[model samples]
Target: MEAPPVTSMPVTGGAVNMMEYLLQGSVLDQALESLLHRLRGLSDNMDPETFTDHELVYLLKGQQGNPFILRARRSLSHPTSPWHLRYLGQPEVGDKSRHALVRNCVDVAASHSLPEFLNEMGFRMDHEFTANGHIFRKGVMKIVVSKLSRILVPGNTENTERLSLSYLVELSVLAPAGQDTVSEDMRSFAEQLKPLVHLEKIDPSKQRH
Candidate 1:
């Protein structure tokens, strides 16, 4: 049987925002693949005795990396903290950043070197990290990505909140009772930065208003 002809046109119209298209696009497709691999491994863990120590680490991160879940102990012998825990304020912030660079390829996108493209879209490079000594920056955009990740739920929905764009806005990884709401405030700024996507945000407005 002959398949229907396919149009090569880019999806347009509707809310039709660039970020929305990207969110439901080839880029999203690739992100899903990495997330699936991570989840499949986690699922297999119900029978831990069947897997090797190395295989366990492959599914479960030790000390660092995966966000929703943290490696409690770096090794079977040594136990302290992942060092990054010094920064953990809540699970939402932690979940927001979890598997950030690992899936979104925001780290890979940072490598694109298109400051003008990013800026024209009202974005900037702030946070920088090196993979094999190559520096990459996400600036405040990283927080936006973290938020979008929450909204999108990607492959880690169990941890990432995905309840309508509005509801999730109220969702943040900060203490609810604090006289301060820095994490929620930062999420707001990062969301307004015009879609750079977060693994990251602003500091000044990041506190209680």
Candidate 2:
């Protein structure tokens, strides 16, 4: 799949400095067990929580192209929770050696009326899907192992089809921008996963081409 487009938006309150560092990689079927074992050993706590989420991707058309891509997501398991709205900007590249991605982002917790509000703003729902995963947290980093599936019918997340057999693994952290040291931490943590899955930044631009 092509990566989502990036756009700039004004920051509200303390979110001005908040930037997200991410590394994307995949786990083969045979290697999943080893990776899970390593994660259990590395985490501060014993158990990891699982989550199922359904996400809707929305796009706003502009004169040139689709200028804004918005992601609205809500948990499938927890019906009471509100939906989440997120916007991620272009990846920031620093010195040539870094493998972690830094991007400007905005995340909002929205009420049930979010879809109506977005429609009023002229955004159209483009696509939707579901992901089932186990999330492990270690200090500042979040490690997710998930499998994506396509929604067979709109607004009916229960009926879906698997997109692939391999699991998508992502290691990420959200921190204030200019915190270069966070990359080092991300690298070190990823190293522990080792041969099971080599987690590194996958440039979205490269993926597009």
Highest lDDT against the true fold, candidate: 2
For 1-209, candidate 2 gives per-residue lDDT tens digits of 32342224345654366778998899976778888888999977947789999999999998996478889999999978999999877686544565588787778899978889999999999999999988999899999999899999898998999898788999988887667688898999999888788998877878886
lDDT, model 2: 0.84
* lDDT (Cα, tens digit) per residue for candidate 1, span 1-209: 32121122232322221110011101133353343333234232332221001001012223677433211111111123221111111211223332111111001112222333444544333322111100111222211111122312222223433222310111122111221334444444434432322324222224547
**C-alpha lDDT of candidate 1 relative to the true structure:** 0.23
lDDT of each: 0.23, 0.84
Candidate 1 global Cα RMSD: 22.1
Q: Estimate each model's TM-score.
A: 0.18, 0.89
Model 2 residue 136 CA deviation in Å: 0.8
TM-score of 2: 0.89
